[model samples]
Target: MTVRRPIQRFYTEPAPMNKLGKPHLQVVRSISVGQAPNIPDTDGVNEMLAKAGPSATLKDVARGILDRLVERPELEVQVEEILFLKDCLGASLEWLCSLAASDGAACFKRPLLWSGWCSRCDCEAKDYLMIYTKQVNANSCPGTPGSRSRTPSVAFSRPPSWESLDANILEDFDKWDFDSFQLSEATKGSPLHFAGWKALGGFLGEEPSDVFLEMERTSRFLEAVEDMYARQDTVLYHNNVHAADVTQCVHALLLQFGFAAYFDQLSILALLLGAIVHDMGHDGRTNSYHANVCDDIALTYNDISVLENMHISKTFKLMHSDPSTNILEGFKLEHRNRLRKEMVEVVLGTDMSSHFGNVADFKTLIEKLGSDPAEWHHEPKAMSALRVMVLHAMDISNPAKVLPLSDKWSDLLRQEFFLQGDEEKRLGLPISPLCDRETVRFASSQVGFFTIIVQPTFTLMAELQHRVKDVLLTHLQTNTEAWEARKRKEQLGLEISQALPLLKIRPLESTELTDLAVFPDTGACLFSPSRGGSTRDVPCDSQSHGQPRVPAVQRNVEDVEGSDDETALAALAALACCASVEAQVAKGFHKNRPAAPAEAFALFY
Candidate 1:
């Protein structure tokens, strides 16, 4: 008979052979120790043994390999674990664990764990690993790592507890100078993260533990926010600084009117988050520019609120891109859905095109709720409308800030507008209003923007938040006056340039001479001794003067040169009226009775 060695089958290493000539199943020794001894592979014998008894088969070996793989500390195992957890606990809890893992919390203490017995199993059991947090003045569990047996001897200053935040704190918000809260000084690189944490802790009355967890996700979310705004496409103005400014302003506004008390924690969260991300990934261009150029963003959003839609959608996409930054990680499915809806609404409301409609809605809500604070406190829809309005107000509040702050923001905004104008010129597109730096006066543009947009928006806001009326109106008036003063200064400079040639200090250049024909009555032929020019005179009533003639009124050259700016302006005004009268006489207007200088001055002024 031919002798053939028994095949090793699935085992990589050969099993030890017993004296009886049967192979010992070394891999299954622990599990099948109490089972029947291994038998030789014979057709009838194997079938009889398989039918007769339960044995460790190829299935047992495969199960053992899978269990070991799941427990291994490898990237593959981590990916598998994530998929498994996601399947077991659904997306929300899985997201929370993912963020916790990124924050080092899951590394030290497994985020998804259970120490209690399973009701279904009815036996003593442990699922995953338990987290043992260090506690002050608490005894350490014997086997727990990083547990404290005693409180720390050193005292530390902690943030105020939620219970300590009262009406007094809310009332004091109006006095707080928001400019003093610089993100560079306070948050290092994450102002929105800092603002979100403080707003939740101080205003929403969240516990320290809850705030700490929320901050983990907020920090992650802010990472994405920072990255998006740091891209090459991002411009100078609509960046992280602007987002932080709006967030801080929203927080202040919430406290200003006690909206914190009126809205729930979720609503407040949405409002603050909305402010922080309302302008996310702004390309420093307006929606009109996008639509006019048929840009991808405009086409995607159907050319309506293009930038706003892009900002909000990109924000949510970043929030889901990583587990670490998912701000709504642990929220219930319904709450998460609702928060997203509300946040999108609030962010979309920031579009300037929707500003008046949102303000009108808010005003109608306020009217329905009545002027009483008590009545306004309980209506959810009204409070939501107010929240949207508050965020919108904060978005546009930069121009209403104090002079120094507003001027800085205005300069940055003008630079951005000029850049767009440059792009438009390059593309042969019509330059947008207030975008052409060569033609548009910054101060005059600001005056129009303030009067047409900023003033009316804030006026409505002031009316709604009565306590902030004085503060808002004060800053609005101050900023408006500043812009108006700048406009007047600019206008005065232009008038001086136009009047310079009329003074006739020297012979007119070609451009100046051309300007002279338009002002026939103001074309004087007085020579300047200071300029070493010979004296000449011209009659004001002459239609054309080929040669200089003596004027009806003569003044000393020394007196004219020594006159103040006000005197020069007055002379220009008088000459302007004279030209107006000449033109009217030429047209047979007021022909019978020419108006006097005083009457013309009154009409012109």
Candidate 2:
């Protein structure tokens, strides 16, 4: 397996960048937003003070649209389109991330000014960004992977349709079986706002009854998160839908099992908000990828829980700098601090490096609590522990979902994994586990994931909340069996392909063979009766979508009637009866495929 090899290889030392080491800039509440412009300082104002700089002017324009967004009871257009239009800052992926990280006070405030300075690092032009990353890795040069992409800054170029969301699909969002993907499609690529709205506004019910924060603030914050996860070339599994998924799961874990009843409004809101922003600005690479590559962000965070630390820091900074994104703006200072602290703690707890240990620690706590989730209410530490486990579990809980959702999520995750593997292959770094596409088996890999990570997480959930126990474990079992079945079929195809050359006898000259496909090189027939003209049901269809599914010739060649070597003839007939190595080739899997299930062995031997 190319699994451990690539993950183990190390590249050159991280180039030291003094600029990267600079302190993370904090926002100082700047010029009052939405105030009337000065009456023309030409009359009696000092020359230096009356310059009316770009920052002041840019803020004036960006803020011009802010009032409309904030005050309008609803938006007819997508928030991103309105926010990222030319009249506003016209932000790029990197600039948006930088704003969340350090440049917020300047970038968004004076986007044009910073544009000339950092336009090269646009995250939207990911091909260029990747090229620059490779050049840096190849040279071990004194530059950060992202900041020097030298690509043109792009407009947020809104993705998906800008039409209004389908209210019908969103009506079922509260259910455990709710599909975040469907929500994303319904919300025009901005489902987080609706999900976030429900988290704070609807879910809170009359908690702290008097205060009502506008959806605008919460939507802005959540939209920023969705924006950060959008990448040009990379497919992001931790995008807004995953964020919404975690938020929903956190709610179900808390409210369904009586944990929310114990926690106050603020604490519940803290956990929900944490789920919303936990993966903000995710670039789809794991922490180990960052640390190994010596990415600028990793260096800034000291290579320890680098992505987690960056997510919370940049995200909170986004909230701090923009009133539109700061949902906690009017709360009591102490309440804000408490919520922020808990949010940060829970987000940090999502890093996988500490996953098993955290799970073990939480398991120990569960043992102490003796299957009672209500006991967590009295134990503050236990409550905190529960919060950590819930988010971490839901964050990785796709496997515990129904077949299609799990399949869709797995496909997305593999896209991300292979993207990283592609980079690792280029940089000569060891490919991390499950990242290498050429060597990894899609179906079998998930079976191990189910065993190691997925099972334990839901087991803990079952221990904490019995209501969800059957659904969670049942989905897990179904998904596991489906993958196992797929794995077995794939193995049969592979083994048959391997044994083809041994059939040294002349190829069967048959009149009945209608549409049997043969390898040009091997002369082995690949005949899949099930795949005959139509696409199969998908939960990771082993057959590549590229394959022609139209019905081919159909005939079963069984034990060549009077064959002298009966066993050989029988093996050949069975081998010729089904799919083989071409299936793997069609799916773009090369080099090595996994071989585990023994059921395939019984067929030919």
Clashes within 3 Å, all models in order:
1, 8
TM-scores of the candidates are 0.58, 0.59
What is the alpha-carbon lDDT of model 2 when measured against the actual structure?
Answer: 0.55
Q: Which runs of model 1 end up more than 4 angstroms from their true locations?
A: 1-176, 180-182, 185-190, 200-213, 230-234, 372-381, 493-568, 573-605
- Where in model 2 is the C-alpha error above 4 Å? 1-164, 203-214, 231-234, 256-258, 493-555, 558-605
Clashing pairs in 1: 537-549
How well does candidate 1 score on lDDT at residue 536?
32
Quick one: how many clashes does candidate 2 have? 8
Give Cα distance to truth, residue 52, candidate 1, Å.
80
Instruction: Give a tens-digit lDDT track for model 1, residues 366-463.
Output: 56776544467567677667767778878888776777888877888888889999999999999998788777877888888888878777777666
lDDT of all the models against the reference? 0.51, 0.55
